[model samples]
Target: MASTILVTGGTGTLGRHVVPLLRGAGCSVRVLSRRERPDEDGVVYVTGDLRENAGVAAAVAGCATVLHLAGGPKGDDEATAHLARAAAEAQVKHLVYISVIGADRVPLAWLRSKLAAERAVADSGVPWTTLRAAQFHDLTLAMVEKMAKLPVVPSPGGLRLQPVDAREVAERLVELTLGAPAGLVPDLAGPRVYDLAELSRGYLRARGKRRPLMPVRIPGKAGRAYRAGANLTLEGATLGERTWEDFLSERVA
Candidate 1:
């Protein structure tokens, strides 16, 4: 593998950890961001946007591997499609994309965008690998905080999640990026699954706050999908070692 790697979202939650690991593994890293950042040791910064072909081309050019991670529900599909075309032209050796578990099965708009991005990478004519991960522990905590703001904590009934650590996901992404493209790898999830109410209670326990949780059914197809556990993978999936409680412990410390 060549020593240079391009990570599209190096400033993101997972990318912050991934960039350092890549450098420690003896690879020079380049980060693409709209905002200018000072270049650090063993890392380079490139100012670019994924939406424009010119920006995408500059970032994709002269890289051994491209890590497509920066995206939102509105632009992920088109942005990834543009990246695929640029990467193919550059003949990038490996293109690794991060997606969410149940992206294909879930009926949410964000998941739908992710599924389209995955397909774009597959059809790009470039060597590629896509790994789907469960929700991050940080994301779970954020949701808990949001719900806690209500006078009465409202929890979605029958909603379950397996929130893995972002650091673990970053490590797995780096491992897959360095190796040969394996197409779609097994999904990664946390060690255990917890209901939304239980997770919120765990957060409350960590924060030393007491609140009553009111279970309610979420309306629409998205809600139905989540209630069916569409956002989780429990069959022969790779399990992350860090538990949500462990994450809270770290936060408290």
Candidate 2:
């Protein structure tokens, strides 16, 4: 029988690519989602929310491995714990997690939630591998769109990030799923880092929009964290192939 892998959040950005890769590797894939969808060839789609223990348990049944990627800005701790418990109950062999780089160092609420999820996975007693990566290129584009809508793009001076391609991250994740559960693997970063203001300007230039860049000093712990470079990978870890400029041009064109 082919090894079965359960992919949580299989309908998401990274999942879309990871699922296909796993199928290509001859692994039968079962995707957990919130909505029911028709299963594709060599893939099964199971509708369930991570918050529901019974649903998660059902999704993990008979699966040898799990790709736990369902996470958000809220209830991440509880959600991760629920999934961890489910994986344990189902006796899943390996649990692969996708986490953010510098999650431990960043003071943002979202990062804290991600760190809490990581802790839950560690304590789940299941063999796990966590891949911490920089912000996705899609995430950068979303940020730019949000900022473009605002009257002024608020750029916290000195904030830098190494935004990586989501597809590349997904490919690395697929490779990790086949390996042993190595805890807290090296950080995955992009080709280079750029200041927030400079990136914003790059976006504006790409889109042919002339908007005033407002470099402001945000007054909060989060702002301080950004200014302190909390979002960057300091160890110079695995660099992805895609550059931000290349991503920007492709996205803009």
- C-alpha lDDT (0 to 100) for residue 38 of candidate 1: 93
Number of colliding residue pairs in model 2:
0
Q: Against the correct fold, how does model 1 do in TM-score?
A: 0.97
In the order shown, what is each candidate's alpha-carbon RMSD? 1.2, 1.3
> Per-residue CA lDDT of candidate 2, range 1-253, in tens?
8888999888888888888888888888999988889988878999888866548888888999999888887877788899998889888889989999878987877788899999989999999999999999888889987898788888877788899998999999999998888988889999988988878888888888888888778678877887788878767589999998999989885
List the global CA lDDT of all models: 0.90, 0.87
Candidate 2 TM-score versus the reference: 0.96
Candidate 1 lDDT, 104-195, residue by residue in tens: 99897888999999999999999999999999998898899899888789988989999999999999999999999999999999999999
Candidate 1: lDDT over CA atoms? 0.90
**Which runs in model 1 stand beyond 4 Å of their true positions?**
none
Best by TM-score: 1
